[model samples]
Target chain A: MGKKTNLVGEIIQDPKVKPLSPHLQVYRPQITSVLSITHRMTGVVLSVGSLGLASWIIAGAFGEQVFSVAQLIISYWISQLLLFAWTLCLFYHLLNGIRHLFWDAGKGLEISQVTWSGWFVVSSACVLNIIFWLIAYGFFAKLV
Target chain B: MAREGVSHWWYQRLTAVALAPLTLWFVWSTIQLMGVDLAGFRAWLSGPVNLVLSTLFVCTLFYHMKLGIQVIIEDYVHDHVLNSLGLIATNIVSVVFCVLTVVSIFVIVFGS
Candidate 1:
């Protein structure tokens, strides 16, 4: 028989076959690109953020004097900088998480929609961060 | 077993939904806690409802953390040895973080 339909023959390579879809290697960088990776990075950041919060709680459980020691460190300029960065990460992650929910609901898949949403996410994170710090400073002014 | 992948995926969304409102509440609460000391912090947490919410927050957040980390490691680390070590370490870190925080909260609420 000239069938030539053995299992081994069926498994033979077709090197001529093109990949069905584009991958990371083919894409050019864009707002969506940055936003995409930042989303993952923020997830990592928020995990550390959880640890930071828990550590703060644990420090408080150590009594006032001990808590004050940690507080002293946090009061320093560098710690303030880190806290700001952490805050940005938290807000970015939060906003991006919502963006992801929208994507899950099958919205924003078109190129134009994705780009607009990407910029929206970026601006929202930055604006929200500034507002947060503004309110913090405003509160501090009142505390004086 | 019902598909491992589906359960993992399901938990991700479930925890995400749980986190949404909790995160907003947390941000609000933290801002309000500004300049507050240990006593104030303890007092806020001492409420039964707070105790329950905080526990849920910590548990779900860390569980989600572990799942996220697991997927990242599995995807990026091709080396078998390193891949496994990364996963084990992440698990330990998540477990330890939750355990310590929860225990600390308990101690604050009710000393041994």
Candidate 2:
């Protein structure tokens, strides 16, 4: 049997070569660019995290047996790690969401200031997540 | 002259304004519910105030998420089909999640 033709090869083999649009590698990263990309990434993460919430709710509705199973899974070491990651994603998404709201309001798009603020928001989200986890695990001894 | 961008600006502002209190309440509620057992958690959520506040929070949160995600997809996804699909899927998922949240709240609050 003949080998299947790759789409890219077929397109490239065409006699009429169209000029391609500029790609990501051609452009420098700016604050808005970084924030925009990170926002989408965090949004995707949060979307996945919603599934965890859904599982909890459905388990709660089902009854205690299911809830106990969920509790065991959530309290497991690996699940705890994932939960910590999800919490960081949540905070990052929330902070960047606020930043996007500001930009949507026609503010904070200035090059220098926006860049610094973007960094600040990312850093603050990490720090705040750590503080929250510390309070949860240390003070409360909840380990979550 | 009527400002051309005022509508976009106002809508964004409205969502932001709504999200402020809702987000705060959501965080506060989460913190308060930290260590409660199932029945205890359900009892706390069963209150009229908590149920109502959660309803408001879920609605506002999904609305804000839709608006934010719409802009992101509009800006980044260059392919028309993919962009439209993303936007439609975002709307569908948010609506479904909103409904689920409300239903869960009712189950928690009203269901014995």
For each candidate in turn, the TM-score is: 0.84, 0.75
* Interface RMSD measured for model 1: 1.2
Model 2 share of native interface contacts: 0.18
- Mind giving the per-residue lDDT tens digits that candidate 1 earns over B48-84? 9888888888898899899998888888899999999
lDDT over C-alpha atoms for residue A86 of model 1: 84
Write one digit per residue (lDDT tens) for candidate 2, span A11-125.
3334465667777778898767877788778776766676576567656666667766776777788977887787787777778767777777789978877888789888988
Runs in model 2 deviating more than 4 A are A1-15, A20-22, A140-144, B1-13, B68-88
Best by lDDT: 1
Error of 1 at B54 (Å): 1.7
Q: Which 10 successive residues of model 2 chain A have the least lDDT summed? A: A8-17
> Per-candidate TM-score, first chain only?
0.76, 0.80
**Residue-by-residue lDDT tens digits, candidate 1, A1-144:** 354455767644456866677687778888988888888888888788778778987887788887777777777889778878888887888888888888889998899998888888888988888888877667556767
